[model samples]
Target: MSDLPPNHHADLRHSGPSGYISGLTMIVGRGNDARLVADLADLQPGDHVLDIGCGPGTAVRNAARAGIRVTGIDPSEPMLREARLLTRLRRPAGEVEWAQAGVEDLPLPDASVRVCWSLASVHHWPDLEAGLTEVRRVMTAGGVFLALERRSPVGATGTASHGWTADQAAAFAHMLTEHGFVSTDVSNHDMGRRKVVVVTGRT
Candidate 1:
């Protein structure tokens, strides 16, 4: 989720081909990002993890492989469908569940998840503050949360429409602190060809 609803840019209905294309792109190009998130999460066996806006369940699959139970949520039906198919194919040791839900409206109960990650999805949230509030509400005490997004280049076309600016990233980190997340940090990293803004914190 970015600054706008996903449907505003791309409608990913299950009957359409765009969702599949997006899923394939994630499978091939976003492996490193997912792995990075998994490593940061340091998931343990039996731990429950949530992947918000889990496009094709790439991160969910990666974390599940580490023996963590995973729940992937997305607003797109096609994306969720693709995620289930991919997870079934991978067959990770831990259980994996997929749900069609937006970041601001999670289906899980409060304090249920031990860890949560949202990659390239924050900007699409209709209400950033509300979404973060929801995130905090669902996470257990001392739970870890990470959010990552591409840092769009300056003067790049559609930059505003795509990713978060440096200042926005900083503000997001501050928001985490205000929401009672400790050890919060916001930094930029060179992720191969592009830079990314990362926000990490613990409840």
Candidate 2:
């Protein structure tokens, strides 16, 4: 549906009971992506990680298990509620907190996070530049930044167009650099039955 650029699904939002249920069920398949990003963070005990656009807190819980503190921020209260319920059912080794907010505005202090990541969620950001600025502001100098998105074909349409194409991924990497991130890279990987593209950088 869209090409070359990022955040094609900027207008997409998850709210209400139905949206929360869908996030917990349909989008819950992002477990593989969660693990991929958690491993990418390469965090140590007591490090602070920030998860943007966290849904159902899958990646949040996964990373927190590494004995680090994590803040999972989302725009939907209902989704945060679901995340809290699931987290309570199965606790992680590290501390975990949740906030209801969008990428454009994070509820965090400056240079407070060691690693910041978003899994299969960056494309939904309403304002990619503002989101990246917020991410950079929250991350410490030399902090890792990563984003994972399913690989969508260049001309794909409908649901098949939800993810990033190679060019789009590269574009996002460029944006990261523009936002003062260093060593930005764009790479491809596989996640379960899906192919994914990952953009990485350091703030």
Superposition error at 30 for model 2 (Å): 2.0
lDDT of every predicted structure (CA atoms): 0.79, 0.86
TM-scores of the models, in the given order?
0.87, 0.95
RMSD of 1: 3.6
True-structure RMSD, every candidate = 3.6, 1.6
lDDT of 2 by residue, 1-203 (tens): 34547898888888887677767673457778888877777877778989998888998888877778999998988888889988999899999999999999999999999899988789889998899989999999879999999899889889888899888898899999899997898888876688998899987
Q: What lDDT tens digits, residue by residue, belong to model 1 across residues 1-203?
A: 23423212232233368777766666777877888888788887778999988998888888888778999998878788888887778899888888888877899999999899998877666666678889999999979999988876444455344666666677778888887787798877787886777889899
Quote the lDDT for 178 in model 2: 94
Q: List the residue pairs that clash in candidate 1.
A: 1-121, 1-123, 1-124, 2-123, 2-124, 3-123
Q: Kindly provide the TM-score of model 2 when superposed on the true structure, using C-alpha atoms.
A: 0.95
